[model samples]
Target: MLQSLQSVAFAEISLAGDLISANRGFYVLLQLAPDSVVDHVGPYINNPSFTELAAGAQRAMPGQVVYQGLITFLGELGEPRSLLARVCRQGDHLAMIAEHDVRENENLLAAVMDLNEELAEQQRALARANRQLAAEKAEQQRLLQELATAQAHLVQSAQLVSLGQLAAGVAHEINNPISFVRANVATLGGYVGDLLAIIDAYAAGEALLAQDPSLLARIHRLRERCDLDFVRGDAVAVVAESAAGIARVARIVSDLKNFARINESEWQVADLHACLESTLNVASHELRGSAEVVRQYGPLPALHCCPGQLNQVFMNLLLNAIQSLEGAGNGPGRIFLRTGRQDDQGWIEIEDNGRGIGPERLPRIFEPFYTTRAIGAGTGLGLSSAWGIINAHGGRIEVRTEVGKGSTFRIWLPLSRTTSE
Candidate 1:
């Protein structure tokens, strides 16, 4: 039975550590020939050899087994193996049992540890990849938002260009008739003045006709039916009023032409004050009752810029100011337009005395489609468009505001196109 056992090795030794006998399994496990005569087990038992086993056996109580959990053993060829072993004292000898199956369990545990390390590394790499993916997603979203804003700007610019062309055509068509009407009205006023002089002379000659009573009576009846005195005074006033009205129409046409300079698409030297005045005139109806515009213009050199574009910017700022005031209760509102030249730049400032923008909404005022106004009340692109136009001109817009007070938007433009570029 002892020789037939293949995994458990049994041995018996002297209490003085001499090898007495051993199973055939012990010789086979240690790689020794079956007929080999081993003098001692010291060479085969690498760790906890025969000497250490003997001492451990002596320390134990009588017939008690001491288990050495795992011990390294060497073969005759110096190969190493591990065994779970136990030793016991019996009579004048020691009995030992060692199991070769413990080595398989140790190898399995080592493999499990290596797998755990690889799994941990893979988890760390997945976490880093997730972080990178998150960053890329955020960047993509930002880029998409920018693209949407750019498209909106392009659409708005196209609409403005079309509107400007229409305004220019309309102004041109009105200018021709208005010019002839103005000249004819002036001529009519002169003819009316000459006719009034002749009527006065006829009135003076009527005294001579008083000598003929019947003729005088007839003349007096004609004068009474005609109301000649009132006619003489009212005709001159009516003609003058017509002339004035025609002149006003002509001025409006001129202002409209100036405001929508479709022909002046390219950069050119333009008066900043003139541009502002033309814009104000074009938007006069919007300001008529909503607010009062006060101009505080200073001396400034002509600027190199697209006048139509600048006029559009001015119109936006002015309209914004007017709306701000209109929203502020029933009190009369004031819009102050100020201009000046500082260093190499000329600046135009539009200020209003109305309820101003809150700090929470101030920073994003120039962001596309961002607004504090109620839905449908505003498209929210006016300020942003103005900002874009100024930036394209190598200029900037500065805003100053207080919660309940008002806001001021100052536009700074370079004096020369070369410098601005």
Candidate 2:
């Protein structure tokens, strides 16, 4: 067994610490000649406890002793190599030594540590990228919210401007009826004075009639001269007319109030014709001089919408139609306001027989700040804001026109409740 073990390429040493022989494998591992290895055996070994190992090996049974140590070859400055060695004593002549290489295991440990650090670096980079992307997304959302808020304010401003334009016409409409009511009241005041005088004359003369028969004739002459009967008949007519005038003024004011009250933003179910009527009345002053309005009101259902916003939209389109008729000389322009429902949709059409939109300008008319009207005469926000409102209400506006002939603006709204701003 000992000879076969040596043949398997283990090194051997004598009891005197001299290398007896070594196999080709040992010389190949150290890249040394067997003669050179034998010559330097004692000096080449780095272990200081080899003497103890040797003593232990001498007493130990064959193939029963093991030594774990590092070996440094002579004249080599490289790190010592780790080895697992086994010692076998044979017949008091020699001990056999065998070694296994463990240097690659150390190199593997260093490579693994480097790979762990590299992986940690990549993880940090990915985490930073994720943070940057999150910040950018948050900023984008904030800007979008600001933009939406600005658009809402712009639409509200346009509505207020449209109402300001109607103020003059509303005042005029109210003033006309008030003027007549005041005049009738003044006439009635004069009639009251004359009738009171006649009453005083009759009441005083009744006592005098017993004393003098001429007193009754004087009372009759006073009534005839004052024309009390005619005054009494006319006063009834004047009072009735004055009441009608007051009612007319009240109606105009009520309509104006209804139109103005549409500023609420919440959606509600409302009559489409009522909204149209209010809008028309508000724009009546603009229409009076520029065009004559003809209502072609059709059957329409109550629709769910923001009534105030819809009123704003209706006023905008109606005002635009009236303004388009500005130069229709010789006769008043005609504006046809129509409403109807078909299927699940309700529509309003404002058509005018006046100057129509040019084909080039028509496409851009709904663009913000785009207008064909003279500067200071229009803010150019009316139609654009109207478009935004209708869109937000789940509705749309359509237009048809021929240059110099006429133009029509039609708005179609869904009957169901719609989400809006």
For model 2, give the RMSD to the true fold: 22.5
User: Could you tell me which 10 consecutive residues in candidate 2 have the lowest summed lDDT?
Assistant: 1-10
* Best-fitting candidate, scored by TM-score: 1
- Candidate 2 lDDT by residue in tens digits, 21-125: 676655544556544645535544555344655676678544443343443333233345434444445435344343453453234334434544565577689
Model 1: what TM-score?
0.64
The lDDT of each candidate is: 0.80, 0.69
Question: Model 2: what TM-score?
Answer: 0.53
Clashing pairs in 1: none
Off by over 4 Å in 1: 1-140, 208-226, 329-331, 418-421
lDDT of 2: 0.69
